[model samples]
Target: MKKLYILFLFACTFGFAQNPGDIVITEIMNDPVSVSDTFGEYFEIYNQTASPIDIVGWTLKDDGTDTYVIVSGGESGTGTTIVPAGGYLVLGRSDDTMVNGGASVDYSYGDSGHTLGNGADEIVLLNTSMVEIARVNYDGGVTFPDTPGASISLDPSSLNENDNDNGANWCLSTTPYGDGDLGTPGAANNACAPTCQTTLGASDTVCDSSNPGATDDTYSVTLDFSGAATGETFVVSTTPSGFTIGGDDPTSTASGTITVSGVTEGTDITITVSNTGDGGLCDLTRDITSPVCIPINSVDLELIGIIDFTVLSGGSDGKAIHLRATADIADLSIYGIGVANNGGGTDGQEYTFPAIAVSNGDHILLARSLTAMEAFLTTPGYNLFDVYLEDSSEPSQNGDDAIELFKNGEVVETFGDIDCRPSSDGTTVTCPNYQFYEDAWAYKDNGTWTYGAAQCTDHDTGNVPSTWTTFDTPCVYPFVAALSTQEFSEGELSIFPNPVSNGNLTIKSKFDGEMKVKIYDIMGRQVLTAEMKTESLDVSSLRPGLYLLNVSLNNLSSTRKLIIE
Candidate 1:
């Protein structure tokens, strides 16, 4: 009889051993977005069998560090722990009631010695006899990636315990359960689907015009789609008026290059691609600013002159530099070189050109003040092609300082040397360079350095003025007429309402062959430029300030002062 009793006990124990797939680890909130791990961390177990399972002696553990024993009732253990079939049991930190998106906390594991890791860890569920029921070794961003504020849920369609272990069968929860957060903690899992994505390829910068000295430009971009249906058609388009598509409207391929032409330099351009056939998933857009065309060589630009000092007091007009381009160039950069006045080493300042195009023979003035520079010009009412403000040491110097021009970080031209000792003390002391009077100026004449007399007067190219000039009044250089005989007729090219209040300022030219017009602000920054085939040129986009307008026809050009209110 005793032998029979022992056999019956062994059978009962074996029958009570829970199956491995009876209870599955269905969802986990290992990484909660912005919430404290102690309060928001949790793991969910779903009873997958057809009957209720008594989990009184079941244990939930993480990576052998934490173990939570299933108890009957509250924290102290009052009743049996029973999980109904198809029901969920959430075990989480008990410090906060709102954790895990406010789901009903089935068991408190707050005092557990271990915490869920955001990167990777293992979660295991065992029966009373310490037999493993289910285990998941999840890698934070790898096998089981983190879904901050959302729980990682197992697909309901694949409810087997073996499926739960494989991270591929799991996904981030999409159901909004609590506090506007995503995760179906105590509910059914959300349906999952394969996603298709589309992306834009790199953009290309190209000259706007194919002409030999063209500086204005546009760009081309390609669109690529993945996981798209066969024979899918996409429509490519661009924002703003300047851009145009080069090919047919609809393309029936996964990847295609879209030729974007006529883009305005310096303006932001956006390219969009959409599925034309079904108007479905493959739709996306990208933005890029039209880039300036850079000069290929330094020979394309020339540093022509410098207005070291002006009679005007304060502001940028007090100092300035001049440059002329022999070919159409864009994005030209200039740098100033000098010895530190603070008794330090060499000092340098730099300026870069914008996307505005500079045509051949275009003269640009970089000044301390466009207003003051214009005010000091001997040629009254003449506009500067461009004016740029210098943030570096003022071009005004005492002949000791040097100014260096750069193109693409390479030295193009240099004036003066910081190491040249031109002056000496009576005894043994010597200075690096001599100093010039405040009213004196220098210019590059016929490839030679020429110093002007104290009083302003335009002189031809030669280096003789370096020793012949004496200090007197503030020296000045007036704009020279174009050497060509195609000069515009006097008063032929004009802009109405000299001081325009509305943004719109119209340009009217009497001599009308193809005319290219450009406007510059006092700082020497080109604000607008366009090839005008018509009489009307718009100045409405210019800010309220003093500006110079240069209108060129063939080899001839004229300038006029303009004011925008």
Candidate 2:
């Protein structure tokens, strides 16, 4: 009774069919782990015709040395050998439910005569005439899935002789049969949509770095792709070596982006992706040039000058700051400016720069009013301004105020000590280190600030250094940018032996007749004063520390930070 598959031969009466769609191999469980190969190994076939497909005497064989004859079954008592339209047929090595992993075996191919190969084998079905009706040559999971305990099933929606030929048309079955093994034997198969790499290429511009505020110029190459199989892992590599390509290996999804870090700029890259396990069918390759990295410069500038007056009527404008770039600033938006009114401390950053790039030594005039600045620059001696931007904000300083330069919301540089207020009792000359100015402008020379001659409305004597020969009554501000930055640093004035290790320090300048020298300590107290008859001055009398050295020749003066050891 257990070996009763011959019942299929007694009750079945359908003869041979000739339609190509009559029968198609739908699934295979050659590598089943639930049971031994002698009992659990099996393959499934689906009937495509509207009528039953009976393999009464059809020969089931392989290309090499495996063959089985469909005869009077040995273990099926149900006599279900005839596959009804849209039904399945499961043929295996054993017929007993206990030994065959619970699969309802329709007919038993003798375990001695025929068995499916676990790797690289062909399945051939022949009709009564010995003519090949259908065949599937699976190459050992190299192309098709090879997961253990799971049978490879054809896509049921397109179940046909031609569609079953390609390995891509099959998927590992997940639906478990009665044996608790994964397969859809003796029934319709689950769907299978094979995913393979379709395309790959760079999609966006190369950025300076993956991080913000970083100017280290980290190079990267990012590529986007589609069609990598879900369960399969794809490998990405670059030809020119030295890169951490494909972060996380893109196993997260079927399609997305993969980035290559640690890449060097200006290297020619050949990006290759082995989508398929063997790279046999679906692979991606692209050729691209790693561009030169563009760095985003942080706030790096020197506060070169500032102005606080305008001759134009209704003098609510003409307030500005003069800046010189220390590097190639890629973005200015991170830099801001603020004015500390009166003796008050910082008022926070009030004016942010727009998106602009400034090169080293380029002078900038961020002003309160463009119209007022242009009208004022028309004065006879105005030049020096390179780049101009107008905005009514923090830099709108009155005559008596301090200016702070901000980078990333923090102050990096400050001009005119914010907490220091000028003291004038009408009799004594104004405070020596006073930052106040009235109806005038101030310019930076040798990294220190000095004022242009103008009336000090608050104080009678004013007692401030002067350089401008022309000043309009209410607001006559003149600027003389006679030398470029290079000439100013290298040609115009050069001071050497500044530490005054011995007694004498050398000063190189265009003049040699006579020069006035005034040295002040950090507290703004005039410490040493002298008149240099030649290029050498004796400073041994002063103690060792930081000091401000103001040198004036024929009214043109320059103040520099001096250090004594």
Candidate 3:
């Protein structure tokens, strides 16, 4: 009788330990593409219970011999690692804060014995007495596929522990975090389940009716009925309206294609399909957000010019130059001058125009290496011109080096100061232009190069963006023009109350003939363009900073510094 009573007590105690769904493994980033696994590997856990749980003495172990004990209340073996209700906890390496793709680590397993498997592994959670609570046996590209530099997140809608073991319940994380890594660590899992899958097809263009030279936009989309029942129907709609759909709605029988028309130029739009089937089992719906645009081609082509340059070492990425086409051009060649860094330097590197065409108002990125540039920007969507320049001919430009763009063997645009400073070896002999450091970009404003903010890229043409302004920050070198040119001083131009505090700046100039007034930020980005019928200009919308005001009349132009407080 005493033996039976002891057995009942043991059963009761085991039942009170932990429930099956109290905690769950939400995300796993076993492999990182940018950095090594030692510094970037991590896993996240979510607490589903309504009250805080003291998880002291809890053991997290992999299929291998590695195990990490949760330390709480400053105790090694017995203490409480209190996890708030409905919160997340990240278990990672000790120095994960330094390299773990910017994930917020709640606890570190240390670096000694904890390493997750990249191919196949098992993660098990246990209570104080070593009783198993949850276990996930995942295999790369199978149970939980591996996506380098991205985490494999479990579907939140299907958060059951039993369903989590299935490979279908897992997906590659699309949530961007940390220095461009993808995952939501120490937070709720991203929604992964899809009622239907939609894909955008190639775009087609026709001549615009409203505009004389613009093109009419048309797009194709394919919708697959994967999670819905047969004979179900869906209604297609688009954001910004005026999108006409052609063809039948999606059904479980096969994938359906729809032609969308009446899209506006230079604007982005989204397409949504909602289930309209009567008495359907599921209200399945899906959306293809932000379709790629088919840019209009143009007859005249002009180099909007280079906006920024990255020259310093140990920067997030390597050197890059931004270019823009005012209008579309076919088979255009862009060659660089003065890129060679030899004892007797010559223009050696040339990027021949590819057979493919560039669209009107499109931005082009030229870099030393496409792979290095993508890794630095953390964006892989940039279309790079594939021309590998020799090391001696690459744009290894300093502040004083000149980079000129050539078209048809003619200099269309030029950047940098040719004779301001000379190169040096940094130690015994230093030059003004050779002072290269990390995170500094040369900004062109009002036909002059100057020091501004550190930015990855600027896609806008003909103007410097506000993102390129970083005033009074250290680690920046100002621009020094060459001897032959005197810009912004050709005309007698002045502004009263130099620092305009009331959002109104008055411009005083000698010439008068319907002067075109343009305002640019310190980075040379034109923010406001208008005709100055009067001397006073309203700058209420502009933020507090330094700006350049360009006043152009008949045959004369002048630039003046404008400060807004």
Candidate 4:
């Protein structure tokens, strides 16, 4: 039955009525008007039939001196060669040859001297005796909205090459394969096989018996990592336009990157290979066998927020030393004291070797999470007012939502839910639910708990706090500690007395400097400017119920809400 199928295919090739063989020119890139160099121009051919056919003696030529002929002797001009049905054949210039391993011709075809533009150009394919088999009179190349470099293409599939002489465009292949979208190689169809990759520690072992008796060689590639450690990977690849393995459709890679991980010591990996297509030296399959796996370990720890400070109040009057406690994935038990003031009057709490003491002029705050570590520090007052997660850990997670501030192993304050930012879950579910409470000061002063405006609240209704928890004390009220939230980066340049009836706003900065101010109306139109040396700005001149005031210093800008009384 196989021989009969072969005979039937051969007969169709000779008949050449309408490409009788199983092969089809799925793609063609023949256009007379296209301005392309050698690599830029080429033809593509695809086999649509179910059987294989030898495309030997296929000759390609342009009206100019640029001529490309397949050197036939075998499969790749090597032996009895055949392009299996449904396969692809990419034919391009010498520059394009690297794309498909095909022969490259001199670039003399589409030059300005030949006037091969805005009109038809003559291209042909011939057999051994110079007998015209296939040809094309490509119309002016197709034009894209933005692309100037484009070519023509042929559609559908055909079995045999056309046996004609003049004026009949016989050049078959013309699919645009360079677009990175691996479609049918030589056919106009943009359908290509999805990439196939091996498991992390697996091999790409494909058998050749699938396409038995076919000249298209099949190789088995084994990606070996035997006798190596763990976590080893390497790139195994092949070149050629239509090297399709494991399937009939044209594919970008028969097999992709192979990696081996968690291998027991002294076990080598073996990856197999297969190359089932027609081209020059298509079966040069190899492997990155017995590769050594390097072991590298790293931890991404982040400072969540400041825990609590071991305040030694006696050493420095009005100043307390703070020891920051951190929790992370790597080391959870031990902690460190980040920044402190080394002023006169030795601190009782030594942090360097035994412990470090906090001195005057030194303020401690929580640092950001390096990985999963949460840092906690005391505001200026040592009152344990506000507990801020690291800027990185603004968003908290489960397990350590509220860090316990212990004084010498005694739980003095239990910071309830923290508010980093807002969430969709509703104010109660959020850590920073301060803004939701109409009377946030009342909630915090009630001796209950201070909620961050970011605490989740359901806005579906009038945005309200759904969950409430009373804390023994506020985390860190930098505002009350004289640190001033306004001095903090986020709270800098805030205007108090929001309902100012006189438009007299007081601007305060952590750092003292001349402040440049600009007031703008709701429409973003600037109406006033006060480059004053004082911290207070009088905006009573501007008529406004609501306005935006921009405070700038050293090119850094901060905005504040301005209300005119």
Candidate 5:
């Protein structure tokens, strides 16, 4: 009887105390966009009970070799790690926001002991005695949000240890955190209740009575929703254009058509359907886009080429994009393009195509300057591109910048790694992070990307996008002989020691009087600006990479690509 009583006491001591579900892993940002994986990985845990849990000696591990003991809390290197009663705490690869993808890390697992896999990974927490507490294994596949730049978050309704294990209880965080990746770390996860899914249906362009004829068209499309219940209200909104939300706006979850009047010919509109909210607790948002109006094409539009032509001034004035239409688009305004500008990602649609129409075989060119664009065309000038628009503010790209193509305020495609810049080797090849195109260009053939020496391939009746030829000498496209002989009436300007390794860079020009000099980095950020009378400028303070030297003399100004090694 005494032995039985002792056994009962032992069960009471271990069973009711420190159990597995005491803490739960709620969020995981395995793939971070603002910073590298080495310093950006992080996860959040919540203490489920009404008692504070001191996790100072707890161990964090994955299914594999990653394992680390918490020697600290609210500190990075080492300290006490604690989870407040019913509160959340964040542990990450680094505690520095500048390096950890803008997350406020509560405790940092040293770089040596932890890493997150972008594909499939696990987060397991254990007690000091090595007893398993809680765990979550997420396969970065269909059931989870595999988008690299965002975090996978647990639904607020499923914040418990039991529900979080279900992949269906998580989603890609839509809330933008610091530096632009999406996730809520060190804070409560976003609510994912009254969840709704959206699908865009067929779209058509028709004459709008508001304009009296077909001169102005209204593009109408249908939005089909699922998983939304009755009494749930959905609000609708559009960007770059206004649209009339038809059936189900502020009503039940019935599908309906939305009509956008006075539609621009060459751009797309983003239609947002959102729940009115259960006073903000059960809100849902889904952004749907207008169809590409491609009757027979399966995928959306494609980016065919990236050009950095060496114009008359040997400047990147010829920065542009080439595209071919897959279907006869009645309105081209449904598409837009933006340069990621250095490594910073997704500066959404800086240039929107104006209202226009094009045939299935038409070739379109979006250029930063039409004057510079004419210099790269057929012999006389302006003969290749079926449609062209010059937007001085857009396609303001350098050799290493990434490009994003937007449809309805969303990035439907990208040309390069929007988050990676050219490394010290003059190429992203070290990381294969982003495609490098300096004294070269890239073209797409049969949906595959191919890089070649900067060459001219004007439209041909036979090859369509036209095959390019490569030449390794003279740093200029051989076809430049047929380029327009447009001279700079403002006189000539040049730079000596063009690829300046160190010391001063000398600016040579006919208008060599007092000049306003500005040097901008590859990202278009002005780093240095000054007014000087002499030609020599000190550049020793600048880092080694690509820069643009903009020199203004009297009323004339010129920009040239300056390389620093």
Candidate 6:
């Protein structure tokens, strides 16, 4: 069996009356709301202190510029409405005719393109007797002088509060702008928005090595090679950067000798190489007989807006939906394909010839710009944007080069044959370093391969090993953990609009057996509880705050946050 709980008429036990002086500005809708209509913004006042005050003839003014007087007919008397102590009252747009729908308000005022400095603004709350009850000059608006200043709300929701302004730290200072670290605001309201930060590119690693095995031989793989975050782990480019190799004179400052560590016989190892600052013919080879050298081809994909995809090749017409990350080169060449313009209604489409499917292992997905892709398709440029990896059914993949094209199921271009060099004798060749090339798939400069274009060739071993050894590493591609033919079960539980409303809460949960639903304030105080099993709770009686809703079964428990307006 299940149970339900309800809390009703449980408040208002004390005979409290709201007094004129008891009204405190609960919130201000605009911290720096632009002065669009001048008489549009309003103030919300709550009766926190006990006593109901007559507000029949009270005048409200902002910054001593705009004045609004409350009236009944032509004469002012006791306030038409008596706000009980601990109650809510709203004052809306000074246009008397516009009544704020059931929402809480104490005073209402609008603005008209009138800019207020980022400093203090004046607010006066008068009583029906024409006497001032609340008078406070709030230090809010755009900042001034040397220090930047903006409004910060007392409550977390950030609704601006003017009266009963007891707490400090309700201001965002603008003094720190233009310091290379903090950017300045454009408009008055812009000061209260979120701030942005500066970040370095993935290829921007310092190449100067610490330890010197010989002279240039001593290199830090971590510093020389780095990888970007993608849906799957794939090689961007098979190139290293920055530091140079020992006893070898290179054109650029950053270059290093190919050093393979942590390798064992009869096992496969993936090595990434990146040339930081120097540009030259660089490749890798396998010496061991037992370990077979596999040629890894870096696959790039481009998609725009929303589009549908199906395999036309690879014998998977209906049986195959291109897995997120799969490492089947032949399959990728066949049905494993990519699409552009998708459904976004963009222009032009470009995708690699072979689209790799998702498997149990890890795979990398590289995204590049259309302009860069066009250059790659038309001209030869090495603008290796970024390499982000994706695995399994993750909702989103890492960020990389973004493209704005369109795709509607038409083979427009082909991913040309990737050329690789061979060592002398041709007996053994360097294994295609997927991780390395994935990092190197950047844009080229003037047909010259850009060095230090970022790569993932770091070794985690404490003491670097001289011999190449294979270790258990994560899959570097998109894959599926499980294939589902049935939908996931909700188990006698349901949540709608996930983020609910304030005051009027509409909850609907169901189960065949008996269940219990309860609501509690953030402080663990049980505000409402019922044993009816399934029903909605009239949360209008609750205050505007964060509350937790707990639904319990025989042994299972689920919780969700209830936001009251």
For all predicted structures, in order, the TM-scores are 0.46, 0.40, 0.33, 0.22, 0.34, 0.22
Per-residue lDDT of 485 in model 1 = 27
Over 265-337, each residue of candidate 5 has an lDDT whose tens digit, in order, gives 3346666655655432234333434333332223235788787765543455667788877657677888888
TM-score of 3: 0.33
User: How many steric clashes does model 4 contain?
Assistant: 112
* Model 2: per-residue Cα lDDT at residue 261: 73
lDDT of 1: 0.61
lDDT of 1 by residue, 367-417 (tens): 656655554453332244554554444554443345666555566666654
Better of 2 and 4 by TM-score: 2
Clashing residue pairs for model 2: 3-74, 4-75, 4-76, 5-73, 5-74, 5-75, 5-76, 6-73, 472-476
Badly placed stretches (over 4 Å) of model 4 are 1-26, 30-36, 48-50, 62-68, 73-81, 95-119, 129-131, 141-147, 156-188, 191-565
**lDDT of each structure?**
0.61, 0.69, 0.57, 0.37, 0.67, 0.34
**Model 2, residue 339: what's the lDDT?**
85
- Largest TM-score belongs to which candidate? 1
Ranking by lDDT: 2, 5, 1, 3, 4, 6
TM-score of 4: 0.22
For model 5, the stretches where C-alpha displacement exceeds 4 angstroms are: 1-17, 73-75, 78-80, 196-565
lDDT of candidate 6 vs native? Answer: 0.34
Per-residue lDDT of candidate 6, residues 156-188 (tens digit):
233233423543323333332221212112112
- lDDT minimum window of 10 residues, candidate 3: 477-486
Could you tell me how far off, in angstroms, the CA of residue 411 lies in candidate 3 after the best superposition? 81
Please provide, for model 2 over 381-425, each residue's C-alpha lDDT reduced to its tens digit, 9 standing for 90 to 100.
334455788875647777667788888787888787677555323
Could you give me the TM-score of model 2 versus the true structure?
A: 0.40
Cα error of candidate 3 at position 337, Å: 75
